[model samples]
Target: MTDQPTTASPAATSPAATPSPLAQLPGAVGAPTAEHYGDPVAEQRALAAGRALVDLSDRGVVTLTGPDRLRLLDSLTSQSLAGLAPGSSAETLLLDPNGRIEHAMHVVDDGETAWLIVEGAAAPAVAAWFDRMRFMMQVEVVDASAEWAVIGAMAPADAEPSIPAAAPNGHALVWRDPWAAVQSGGWQYAAEAAHPAADYPAVELIVERAFLAELAGLARAGGVRLAGSLAAQALRVAAWRPRFAAEVDEKSIPHETDWLRSAVHLAKGCYRGQETVAKVHNLGRPPRRLVMLHLDGSDAQLPPAGATVHAADADRAEVGRITSVARHHELGPIALAIVKRSLDVTVPLVVPVDGVDIAAAQEVIVPPEAGQSAAVPRIPRLGAKSR
Candidate 1:
């Protein structure tokens, strides 16, 4: 393990940066923490085999307490949290009035507190927003990022029932992922019978701050394997998991990422972006859609994040940009991109990197016909006659 060199990435050292517990680990480097501790592919394989654990401690955790906590959150986000039973987990999205995703959180209530797990990059901003929205609500929002460390569970073998797949154990509050299928009140825009996300089994364990070191030591001592961010991210991208930090931009909407499959409750009373969500799903189409790019493996070079994507044809115009890219142990190099909805699905795509074009084959993650299931009622005027 290498010693952590300097402070952090340029982004974290900025004004509102909130550091994480994992930043001090050996070989740890980066803004909030290290990208990996040497071998990313091995780490990824370990995670997939359920023989390891990854430090998602870089993510932020916000705890909401108070009598009106559930009610307040239900009125603010895309999920129905008011009726959520203690020990249950659910995901929700915070969007601008224009339906652009601003924050996403994996929520779990421990009877006394509602733990909101948000991406590290968006934590401080989201925590601040929660403070501003506390007009008259009885909810108390606290940025507990420094108080808790997240332990990720993925690829737990099917034989091990005690691998902690969502069930809370002792002091750990495990938030089970609902991305496997449509929740009770949620909707799946993608019509694929076998959703790629269904194969993704991931969970997060929230532990007390003081235990971070002991956990790291345990991983290093081979008590358990230590996987890196790449392993977790590779599986997430392969599953077509729509992450806010990557897939979302200023114009991003829930429909674009098929996030309604788990994050948004269509029948929920109301939320900030409900209007736009309703309008688009019922009457219009989202400007962009998500896709999985299985990149060409012949070339050793891989496209970096934010790389511009163009259709393979000579006259094809710029369609979208790569949001997240990873080299999967099995898939080689892969990426997740949000492209213009009108881009032909059959046409091959290419990503430009260092003046070179990498061939890409698109696997439709979010289909163009997403949200057609809304089925808006057509009401005729009072003067109209029956056909």
Candidate 2:
């Protein structure tokens, strides 16, 4: 999710300081890693099958050290992190006062430090926010993107031998994807009997920046297969995994993207934007909802992100915009969009890409009735029979 293209690396790190070895590999296209090494479809298949590693050096790393690291995060984020055990991985959100998402982080504690993996463009801001919040607290925030790099794989960290795990303080640094299961104290908006996320078991490994050359050598020597950010993004979109770089905007709330399944603790203590979160879940619905679009693959035109989505019926009014789009290896042309909550699920959608209208079929992700989880009792009528 943090692998988007960028002109400049994170502020704490200088891209000119040391060029990435993976970026120098043949067919590498993007600034940090190869977007796709010639064939994206094959890379997607290999990555999904746990036979390939995704280059994610563009991701940003931040560390919180000192005795109050966990407590500081627990007080500011949506997840209950005070009791997070060393080596445990979790996801959390930093919301604005009105519950709009500002930051989403994948966190892992290694006893001595709590490492946060976040969107590259937002890394310096995240670190600065943490620093601003620490008033006399025994905590130190550092942007570690310059010293560390991230690698993604579909297998667990321990199961992948080619990519060595970093154990700076006896605990290995790995942030396992927790989207497969609804986390404790979290709620789900999608009512599917079988979720696609169940099949997505992915992990992001943190390693020393110096090891990038070795990994590149391993890739070149045929010791390990390499995938690209494009493949990784396609898999994430297929899994319906909400990412900050793709799904979040200034007005986005957790409920709109179904992010509560993994990043939010519904019963956690008060933090910034807690009131809006509780009110939305207990008494109201989000203003918008997420949906997956099966684009008309016959046209061979894949709509890019931010493409305007319109209703295919008469008048063809705009309803939403595409947040993320990809050509899934198995699902053909697909996209994730945020539309008005009241849009008819049965209504067909059309995305205008380069003057032609590309037909799209809607599959609901966050249903229209995506909130009001409170257990309020119904009021009985005066003439109702008593059981």
Each model's TM-score, in the order given?
A: 0.88, 0.93
Residue 310 CA displacement from its true place in model 1, Å = 0.4
What does the lDDT come to for candidate 1? 0.78
lDDT of 1 by residue, 54-127 (tens): 77777778888887888878988999899888777899998777777878899988777788998865666666
* Minimal lDDT window, size 10, model 1: 1-10
Cα deviation at 85, candidate 1, in Å, is 0.9
Deviation (Å) of 346 in candidate 2? 0.4
In model 1, pairs of residues that clash are: 9-31
Clashes of each: 1, 0
| Candidate with maximal TM-score | 2
TM-score of 2: 0.93
Model 2 C-alpha lDDT per residue in residues 242-295, reported as the tens digit of each score: 899889988999999899999999998988889999999998999999999999
